[model samples]
Target chain A: EAGVAQSPRYKIIEKRQSVAFWCNPISGHATLYWYQQILGQGPKLLIQFQNNGVVDDSQLPKDRFSAERLKGVDSTLKIQPAKLEDSAVYLCASRRTSGSSYNEQFFGPGTRLTVL
Target chain B: GQQVMQIPQYQHVQEGEDFTTYCNSSTTLSNIQWYKQRPGGHPVFLIQLVKSGEVKKQKRLTFQFGEAKKNSSLHITATQTTDVGTYFCAGARGWGKLQFGAGTQVVVTP
Candidate 1:
């Protein structure tokens, strides 16, 4: 089976510039998530989407960051006026909705964003 | 809001030695999941513990959940070079959302 796919494995942008990251979840998966992993730290949940509807986004900075999963299969995370503190790897993950026993999340390669 | 914390931010072990990492959550969790991320790689699921005081093993790796369901531990025996990576513990209260710990970075030396 194919895994979650993401584009532009690496990205670099100047401060105050805008950047966007794309993610395509595993086929048939109904839940998608976006996380930010800073250096030497674990991935922080940014937003979650259950079939195109947001489940949680309390930690997201609405002033600068936004994400959407229009059709429930793919997602996009955007950051405007990027700050130097925003330099981190953005990871996308997906999970199936059927089984309740094991909630294993499959993660994508991630997009490494470097804001200069 | 819930928070998860990991101890020994970094661990350096001999190739043949054994070591353990710990995870604790401010709130009781319905389940806890562990994942491993190699250097420069994404996190991969390792195991999950749902039942309180449950213990599971995968080869030389042992996972244990506290009786209170608020903490977890990952013990690796006879560490090998392949074990070099960061181990993260994620705690979920309900479902679909996970609060991740800072993670313990492990380095094995020959």
Candidate 2:
């Protein structure tokens, strides 16, 4: 089975510029998640989608970050007017899961965004 | 707000030496998870502990959950060169959110 797929493995952008990251989840997986990982830190959850509806996005900075998963398959996270602090790896993961039980998450090679 | 902490932010161990990282939570957690990230790779889940005082093992790696579910540990027996990476312990306060620790970076020398 193919793992989660993310595009543009690396991106460099200037602060205040807009950038977008995309993710294609593993086939048959019902849950997808996006995380931001900064240097010397762990990946922080940005958003989660169960099917097409968002399950959680409390950590997403609504002022600058927005994400969508149309038709419940692929997802895209965008940061407008990106800041220096937004420089980090954007990771996307998927899992074969149900509303109840724990499932193992499979991650894609993240898109490393560098804000200058 | 919830937080997770890990001790010995970085550890350097010679091959065949044992290494352990501790994870503590500010509040009791519903579940705890462990992940390993290669130098430039995304985190991959290693194990999850849901029950207090539960212990699980995967090969040389051992995971233990504290009796109060507020702490956990990962001990790797006889570390190898392949063990070079960062280990993170994340605690879930609820179903949808997780607070992760700063992670313990491990470097193994031959």
Evaluate every candidate with DockQ and list the scores.
Answer: 0.93, 0.75
User: Candidate 1's residue-wise lDDT over B16-54, tens digit each?
Assistant: 999999999999999999999999999999999999999
Sliding window of 10 residues with minimal summed lDDT for model 1 chain A: A95-104
True-structure RMSD, every candidate: 0.9, 1.6
Candidate 1 per-residue lDDT, tens place, A13-76, comes to: 9999999999999999999999999999999999999999999999999999999999888999
In terms of docking quality, model 2 is medium
Candidate 1 Cα errors over 4 Å, as ranges: A100-102
Q: Ten-residue segment with the worst summed lDDT in candidate 1 chain B?
A: B92-101
| CAPRI grade of model 1 | high
| Maximum-lDDT candidate | 1
What TM-score does the predicted chain A of each candidate obtain versus native chain A? 0.97, 0.95
